[model samples]
Target: MNATQRTNERPGIEKNRIIRIENGKKAYLPLLLLADEQEDMIDRYLERGEMFVLEDGDRALAGVVVSDEGDGVLEIKNLAVIPAHQKKGLGRRMIGFIADRYRDRFHTLLVGTGDSPMTVPFYEKCGFARSHVVKDFFLDNYDHPIIEDGVRLRDMIYFKKSI
Candidate 1:
């Protein structure tokens, strides 16, 4: 795929552009950290995952990292939109782009995120269903407490969507 491509014509989403980052994935660390928090955890999959960024001219509005997890499964390791651009349908558009682009190659799209009120609903709204849970994922993996939407995160909630 090209490094940059125009998104499909969807009301309120046509103006955005999604770029595939072929190098320097670390350059977007600030945005990546918004979703995953810890750098080390992101490092675990950063090099292996394919990254795409939603941008408006020179500014990166959002980004996502997806890795093929074998057996026709593609996993979203990180996804984040800038605070100023959140809830504007950018993240949803990114997800839609990924699904459309990989529909032929992958059977399922998976994302494992903290059990936070803020994130789970967004995935659910984007057509993902609760698949499984890894208890104490935050406690066990993170060096510090991971909290979101006023809730202390403990488990890693996995969500799945069939492409």
Candidate 2:
């Protein structure tokens, strides 16, 4: 599938905008939940972190949340693209946007995701390298067992990319 890249101009597509949502971000809970799953778990970070929505024309295609982790580190707490919009490079574009948007303010961009066949490779493909893993992160943080791509996720794999 062909993906869109950021550039000065494009034809036949509405201008895409990434907007930082400062208040009432809870309205995108359904979209956010696609990434984090648990509402209470999301609540732990939602209020304190910053949220952004990717909008094209009148459609909101994806959402991401980030938080300052201090020490020149910025963490991608959650990222989710609507099911219908997945695999269209929107997610990667959001990542690239985040990188450019924060390159001056942060040294490293980190994301924690499940160790599943479906996820780790995607992050690696997005220029992120395996940094570390937190054992039992899913089991310890979530109230229920998490599984993806037919595999049970027991650890949280952390990936990092230097800006």
Candidate 3:
């Protein structure tokens, strides 16, 4: 893939890097940049073939993670904003778009993330609240040491929202 073509996937004004996922290879490049553990979930989602992507110009800004969690609960599997794009409200917009997918079908949406001081408020701002805490979140899920800004990681507080 040409660097310019690959990077320029986001359309229109060059800030909306949006792409509808048709296959694993297409989603991999964008997801790899967004996710901390890379695109490990690509194959499983590809098997079901229910994935999509959003980007800013040539840069992949964010991706919404939707997965079947049984009984009409769609889990927001892994929404990641590349480090460069963290402070922007793009994460919120992408999340709203993802949550809108269930509409009236799904009863609730579940998301789990680190329990550190930083993440709890971010989720709260996203309209999610503390439902429960899971021990050793990073150790269980991540492939490598998940040191964020030199702090050792473990456990996660799960949040849920009804729509």
Best by TM-score: 1
TM-score of 3: 0.74
Is candidate 1 or 2 superior in lDDT? 1
* Candidate that would win on lDDT: 1
Error of 3 at 125 (Å): 0.2
Error of 1 at 109 (Å): 0.3
Off by over 4 Å in 2: 1-14
Give the clashing pairs for model 3: 7-58, 10-17, 17-55, 137-155
For model 3, what is the alpha-carbon lDDT of residue 71?
Answer: 94
TM-score of each: 0.90, 0.89, 0.74
Ranking by TM-score: 1, 2, 3
lDDT by candidate, in order shown = 0.92, 0.89, 0.67
lDDT of 3: 0.67
Give the range where candidate 2 is weakest over 10 consecutive residues by summed lDDT: 1-10
Residues 1-163 of candidate 2: C-alpha lDDT, one tens digit per residue: 3344545345665667888899898989999999989999899889988889998765689999989999999999989999999988989998998999989999999999998877777798899999998999988888888879888788898999999
lDDT of 1 by residue, 1-163 (tens): 4434445324564445898998999999999999988999999999999999987766899999999999999999999999999999999999999999999999999999888778989999999999999999999999998889888999899999999
Comparing 1 with 2 on TM-score, the higher-scoring candidate is 1
| lDDT at 67, model 3 | 76
Give the poorly placed runs of model 1, Cα more than 4 Å off. Answer: 1-15
Which of candidates 1 and 3 is the stronger one according to TM-score? 1
